[model samples]
Target chain A: MTAKLSPRTEIRLAGEGGQGMILAGIILAEAAAIYDGKNAVQTQSYGPEARGGASKAEVVIASGEIDHPEVLNADVVVALSQEAFKKFASSVKPGGLLIVDEEKVDSTSAPQAIRIPVTKMAFETTGTVALGVLVGLTGVVSREAIEKAVTARAPRGTEEMNHKALDAGFTAAEKARK
Target chain B: MAVKLMQGNEAIALGAVAAGCRFYAGYPITPSTEVAEVLSRELPKVGGKFIQMEDEIASMAAIIGASVGGLKSMTATSGPGFSLMQENIGYAAMTEIPCVVVDVQRLGPSTGQPTAASQGDVMQARWGTHGDHPIIALSPISVRQSFDLTIKAFDLSEKFRTPVILLTDEIIGHMREPVELPDFKTIRSEEYRVTAPGQEYIPFRNESGDVPPLANFGVGYRYHITGLYHDQVGFPTQRLDEIDPWLERVNTKLDKHLDEIALVEEDYQDGAKVALLSYGCSARTARHALKLARAQGKKVDMLTLFTIWPFPERQVEALGERVDRIIVPEMNLGQLAYEVERMAGRKKVRRVVRANGEMVTPQMVLEAMEG
Candidate 1:
């Protein structure tokens, strides 16, 4: 199903520092801007801790120039940790999509969330499976664009596994829709 | 060139190489360390030198020395490191050395926050050197502009024979966007040329123009360089006759070239009564607010200042006369707002400021417009 997105779509990917949410945000933005010909701006913020502290990456995808780069009110927000969910679930716009990690974030605050075991999927496949899940569920960018972006950005020797993870994510999303 | 996603700091590093900058000396700091990291990898591939100095003070000294030795040089740092660089920045100003200093500003009177963004250094970029000397500072609001302005900083420094500051904040420094860079072969950098012969070369000559051609140290020309007031021959002099001419030339050089130096973008609507004036990241917010205001049928003009130094007094004064009120939004309390008030009158300017490491939001600007 093709996702109907606004002219300007603001997405927030948030998790603990070492969860690679920042890299996932970068990959998502690259898929939209570089591979799909849309304009994108990505900005990030995190605590001083090298790992485990709260971290977030915001991506603004637009058909026109992106001003005010940060997410004012997110159209899409993916929270991979309980802390991230608690902190950012309120920031999602009304009727906006909220995706959360099924096992990591146990919260009823956002009942409309599409729950998925993204971290477990990554453990079974590649470290960037969250990116796959997000794109597969939202269709923010085309599948081919994300494939090319993952190939270009994923680490050497991890491309094959990452592609498999993306396929798995598409399947999971399909199952969730049913 | 095809469009590629690039961060502001990485664009700056590559832009320096494009600008013919061959020497880089800097200590790594958050939000700006990417510049040094990228330069370390890229500078050597182009037959340039990159050195990680012991501290910011030494980094400043190293770039100055490299520039004096006839290479376009640069250094990038955050708040604390930028603070350490002030004394040498002044020295470079006094000596008329051409170099670029990139301050990817983080919050600070001291080290406030390493990753958070702030525009608190606006005044520091202008007067941090502790003298009446003229300074040139440019701020970029986007990734592409960061690359473009870095090259402009080098060109202006070499043409005017003074240190130029790329005064960016952590927001723009770390933000990533798609940019299609120009062809490297087409990029050109301004070079210093000595017109006078070996015996007639004067390092501090002000006879023809405010700026004189500076001779490289290893070149055939020999001259003294000092931080103290110097005469035409570059020797220190306490004589008022010798010092007065030097002061006039150094301080008035940028003023004389204000037309060329002051870079601003003006977006005016027919008969718009209110205006938004901002720079750097805050300009992005103001632009967003302008759109929101206009969508609600409010008439507003927007002016984005790329050149933050020399104050752009003429433009602000004219804007003040045309607009009923000017809303100034920045990350600091009232740094540029003070200048706006000075030009536009206190009653005509409204300040929207935030210094708690968060951006001045578009909502804040919208509220300011209402007020």
Candidate 2:
């Protein structure tokens, strides 16, 4: 095998019921692994019910072969629920950043937290169904290594919505930074 | 340029379409239903056939019948339904049919978890059919692989003239990922030997005697095929001598070609002392464990078995001599580890069993390697 080194990034999302956290992780991983020709591993954990249960999804994107599908301490965690925030905030590495939904999380514990209205955007986009798009957009706005992932993982024939959702997240993040 | 976000199940459906699979028969099960659902919608567009069988047994039978009718066919099922389809799988082996079965495996001995990730079916995919038979099972770690490997499963089934199973877990089945839809091209079918121009054709034998070149039914090859021991002409035979070799030949063709079928990925295997071995989703965890072990200055290597059937003896035997211990972590209660210890000898094999429907994490494998 010819040797080529690919940079690696781990993306994680955690939230309560119906936030599409798992969908976000899968879209990011698959887009990179399949479309960008990177190696990706996507995994998820859900407590029980379809409504109001703790849910978390992790994606490990690597240019080379992915050694681990399980990400113990994420380089990035997007928490969409208060329960998820309390659960996943400490799970991120000290240097890692935490993205949370402003409505759900108080944002007092996290030293470096970026508040994004993922749930509100999800509702406005297409009610609860567009949560997948919200998560997809977050992947696009990550400013990490997942931009390639957003373009790669969009639903077929939904390029317009994918672009709009991603731009929304990016603009939202940029505004928050300012 | 269709960059659609597809679930692993939907990808398998597209793969079945791309592989020229004209027939699909399956019952809806959690995680695996998307495969059936997608095929249901797409098959008609391509003038293919799709049937939601009454149960998995009928589903398996329908697919086999479709294969015999000169159509590439498949079925998808989860743990509970997969168990229902085992007997037909055995029948397919005896009849030497070419087909594919996708098992989006959920946790189970019996409905353990309806929609959770589990590698518990590793050995079940090999031996669940009962009786001795060779199996070709390909597993995918990513959603894209669910597509690519589904196509490969069909190719192998046609190549070996045996039923191939794409063993995927719920995680890989439900997880959506980006997949590059390859340019559509005509996939060539293997040459079939038939009774040409008013001659007797035996569906069970070929010129090379390797695999009986399968002829599609109603293709001018009027041959009878029954599960019982049969003569060269495809007629059932009662003679023990004839029966033994018939079984032997089917077994030998696959066994002799094991090298061609065995697929494994060796990571840092050179001059390694400790062996961290795994397959399916567990392979990823083992890779992490191997890295952690290496960082601690421990000599470790990783052996990932993609082709679990026929148990890559050559690789295992060679690795067995060099490693101090082979640490195997899986989501089941020591199903595959039993075979590993059997083939690699008992002294150095270790089993890290996890049966709670959760993944076999890296910590579990690392601790076992250190232990």
Candidate 3:
């Protein structure tokens, strides 16, 4: 019998410095902790420069204690930059999922990679760059959970645009779903 | 009430929040920046404010200013920034402002490494500010203790109307562990008696404690606060007799609370001939090392210090008499080891120091403990 997926999910948001990778993790953690009423832990590391630095944020959503916060061999690695993929793909354990932005990330080696064109969709829907791309990617991997998170978390005036951007991401991820 | 896994850095920020700190200002520095980062995001949500100032000096100053405006305030920094704020920290001491300072220490006499651990700031935390002052500094090894002691830092800072220092190393700051956060109301900040209405309010007058009741600026009361020596009315004092009382008042509070402030964790206390005296992250390794020594039929007792300042002179002296030889395994050349040697009142002590940034393991401390 095929066992069911546990409610516990560990996700990573990665990109270049200006990619808003940390915002994705922050929203995911807020959603889980504030809405779903589950435990969450968010950890990140970024290099010195704010522009070209490689940045990654790990969000672990578990029912119990999240020991070893470094995200030892993440079950899901989201790569938003080519540099980020090169750095994080090796750290993802085998059989775990890989979510990649097809437009920015060149994922020739990711075994179970899902290619979602978050960049193109982001530009088309929101007319902005980073926030749209972040919302799109966040909504895709998080499914409908990102909507509640964004509505609860986004600044008051930016809600309508963020909601639209999240929809764009969800549609893109659903189309690319294998 | 959720017992979630948290890093020590974030826990310190959470401790600040639970302790009713509504104002935070700091620049981003390694190991300590995470505290500011966490506070920056969460503070706005809780109706508090967080500011990333131009630099550490301005960051430290902004917090001091905000405290005078009637807000429980704090800032966090590592070694290099800590050196920059020494002059302002002295200002807080002289003015007797109530605030907490968190130093997640890193390796440095200067800008050495952004991610390496070191306890080289023991003496710096004690006497970093110029002139004479008695400061309360706490060292936390784990994430849970970091949260707990941060609350204590604010409590002591407010109770004594002085700046309290939370001295943590990079190892503890970066290390993540499970911690159960207590209720905000449960996290207590001492309530010192305020002055009665209409009557004169002496900002530096106290009947119960050595520290006076701090009166915030523009709180319908007028009082002078300066970096120079001051008397009961808060005016700067230059008289020789007043200077003696002024220095005595500052030193006596910490000295009086020395016994109560002393925190030690003793294990395997069977009159062990060899005593391992250590603190901070180095002591975490000693716990395992002492067990190995005990398994080998070696009599070893561990004295882990949670309170680093005021030396815990009496408790340390008592332990000094009980042990034949004291081994202080630290991360610096010889900071806390010097204190142990002084309290022991003899050269019957050895030091196992490491500055390599990769903690001194049990094997290293064991080798020193054997001799």
Would you estimate the TM-scores of all the predictions?
0.97, 0.83, 0.70
| Candidate 2 per-residue C-alpha lDDT over B1-371 given as tens digits, one digit per residue, 9 for 90 to 100 | 46555568888888889888899999999868889899999999999999988999999999989898888999999999989999999989988898899998888879777868788887778888877768898888766777778887887898788999898888778765455677647544444434244565566763333786777888676678787778776788998877777777787778767777887887755678889778877886888788777888888878888788778888887778878789988888888888888778888899998888887888888888767
Candidate 1, DockQ score (0 to 1): 0.88
Candidate 3 clashing pairs, residues 3+ apart or interchain: none
Q: What is candidate 3's lDDT per residue for A15-130, written digit by digit as tens?
A: 87766676667676666665565667666666667766788777767776543334655667778789888878776666566767788887877646777766666643321233
Q: Which stretches of candidate 3 lie over 4 Å from their true place?
A: A1-178, B193-196, B206-209
Q: Rank the candidates by DockQ, best first.
A: 1, 2, 3
lDDT of each: 0.90, 0.75, 0.76
Superposed by TM-score, candidate 2 places the C-alpha of residue B207 at a distance from the truth, in angstroms, of 10
Candidate 1: TM-score of chain A is 0.93
DockQ for each candidate?
0.88, 0.30, 0.06
The sequence of per-residue lDDT tens digits that candidate 2 reaches over residues A1-178 is 0112114566677877676667667656655655566666676778658877888888777767665566766767778778888877887776666777878789887757877776666553321222233333344223333445555555677656655665677566556656
TM-score-based ranking: 1, 2, 3
Candidate 1, B154-181: lDDT as tens digits = 9999999899999999999999999999
Candidate 1's docking class is high
DockQ leader: 1
A98 Cα displacement, candidate 1 (Å): 0.9
**Which structure is stronger by DockQ: 1 or 2?**
1
